[model samples]
Target: METLKGKTAVVTGSSRSIGRGIAERLAARGALVAVHYATNATAAQDVVEAIGKAGGRAFAFGTELGHEGDAERFWAEFDVQRRAFSDDGDTGVDILVNNAAVALRDHFQDATVADFDRMVAVNIRAPFFIVQHALDRLRDGGRVINISSAVTRLGLPEVIAYGATKGALDSFSRILAKELGSRGITVNVVAPGYVDTDSNADWLRHDKDAWEETAAKSVFGRVGEPEDIGDAVAFLASDAGRWITGQHIDASGGTRM
Candidate 1:
């Protein structure tokens, strides 16, 4: 049942939300998960504790992404923990999930330079360098999965800047898949539609009419859950998904159908 019995995984921005879901799902499959957080150390630790109670293995690491030298600091801390987790030589990352991102409600007309720059930093730039830095550590036959958004696929101009970054991420992932294929490393992207996360609680959970409207967007008659995306990632990170590199998987549960 433990498909990833001895594998190691690092999920960025995993202190909560979709990242938390991915970390938990990976741990469920017997991977030793490194729960990476930006600033919420307590939240990250809570995830670790919860995983422990569930009979899974995990640890917490903190580093603010999208800043100078963040990728270097991140992997250094990861190596330290990987050493403590086992005696074998650090094999780098078996699974790397880039799930951290900054989203602001800005349209093309409203998006400021600050908004564009911040989103680009965390959503695109951080993952760009993080993976660049991880290449050395990412073991052969490893998996690199990037979390994306439905905005890129849909004409959601409400978040022009945010959507642009995700589009770039899609391009970045596909190219990596091609390049890393020779080394047996798989790179892919997952684009999620309106999920039921804390981030959407206000409109999707509290507003009755808004909840109905969002649910109607999905043919499933319900909104996607964080676990839905997590399970999808788990499959792609598994041995069964090795042959599926450089692909964009729509995990939106038939959104806008």
Candidate 2:
């Protein structure tokens, strides 16, 4: 019923995969969505086109995160695009989804300093500064949804650094909720287990034995789809989730349950 009829949303790393799912769902719910991409303009444009084809509105923006001035550059492009698209040239946004991240699969001893630093830069540092810089542009009663991982809860040793970064994001969401509560802004985390994305296509979709083993992790006895997490994010971004904040929702299809 177009709950977000006039709202504007920014979803980072939405060129493809789970982030694209969230952006598409938000657009379908009648929000003006800005689909942010790092290096894949074509993929981002494809997502925007797909949303448009679905009778939704979306635009693409490019900004490489995890670098110096990354947040500033992203906002600069975002402001320009938003103003161009807004009917009254308003630049304020109602939803900010931090879904951009890097996954490095390495054990504690095998992980290099460069790998750790890069993960920290993309996963932890970027979101922190993005929120800090976006506060002014984010209106009262806005939603801040951070995409996290089930690895944080499962303590998977392969992606120790990756899990730690998401753990930090969850903590950040809790504290940020309190800080922004007075402004009526809600902050929360949506943690997903192994979803069948291209990133995991090799193991989860291609290899039959690997797929079966992976699916067994969830009590549902199946792999979680991108839409599963996307729908959850959509609910949290909607007004129906007004009373929900400072929380972590496991959109993992009962993984490890």
Candidate 3:
């Protein structure tokens, strides 16, 4: 349970939903979490407050991760906070969850270069460079969990660009695991299917019949929650998953054929 004791984790896009769930889970298991958000300062602060209230250590951070030198700037601010608070002066992160992503749900023909570029920037480019910037700080035997989508396997319509980006992430997870295994660093992907987050709340509420139709595909007979994905991430980040790497675990309850 204390497998992550004395560790520091950074969860990107953690202001709400899946990212928030992952951050909470890591903090609950004894890791000091940095809740990173692109915007929404109040929401990010709320997350930090909630974690603190729950007897966990956490901090709120903000960054426009897709711009030049943004990663370094973000780290500098993060370091100041860590030095001001952490008992040990180590800003080194032991867990990196690349959960920040932007989804573009459009048919292939409807997808524009702008949409594709945005997807690449947030989901693919940012994660790759974030890992690069954190490599030296990521202690050996650390964990990196990439959040991917099951749409890549299911080939969901109207999500071509989003699916493509997730596929790139999944591939990145496999390749990075092989490259980092020698250093005892573990890299894996948690691919989730149709989680009921704020963005999807409208659909689940107004489109009840359609939601049920989609839910029937899963053996669980219901949609997943952010916590469902979070639990899987916590397991992979724990000693319980030391032997697991170079793989993509579909947290999708038998939704894909």
Instruction: Flag regions of model 3 displaced more than 4 Å.
Output: none
Residue 118 CA displacement from its true place in model 3, Å: 0.5
* Candidate 2 segments exceeding 4 Å error: none
Judged by whole-model lDDT over C-alpha atoms, candidate 2 comes out at 0.92
Task: Evaluate model 1: give its lDDT.
Answer: 0.90
Instruction: Give one digit per residue, the lDDT tens place, for model 2 in 211-255.
Output: 999899999999888788889999999999999999999999889
For candidate 3, the per-residue lDDT at 213 reads 81
- Best prediction by lDDT: 2
**If both were scored by lDDT, which would come out higher, candidate 1 or candidate 2?**
2
Model 1 agreement with the true structure over 1-257: per-residue lDDT tens digits: 58988889999999998999999999999999999998999999999999999999998888898788988988888778767767787646799999999988888888899889889999988998999998888899999999999988887878889999999999999998988899999999999998989888877899999888888888888888889999999999999998999999999888876
Of 2 and 3, the candidate ranking higher by lDDT: 2
How many residue pairs of model 1 clash at the backbone? 0
Q: CA lDDT, every prediction?
A: 0.90, 0.92, 0.89
Worst 10 residues of 3 by lDDT: 65-74
- Winning model by TM-score: 2
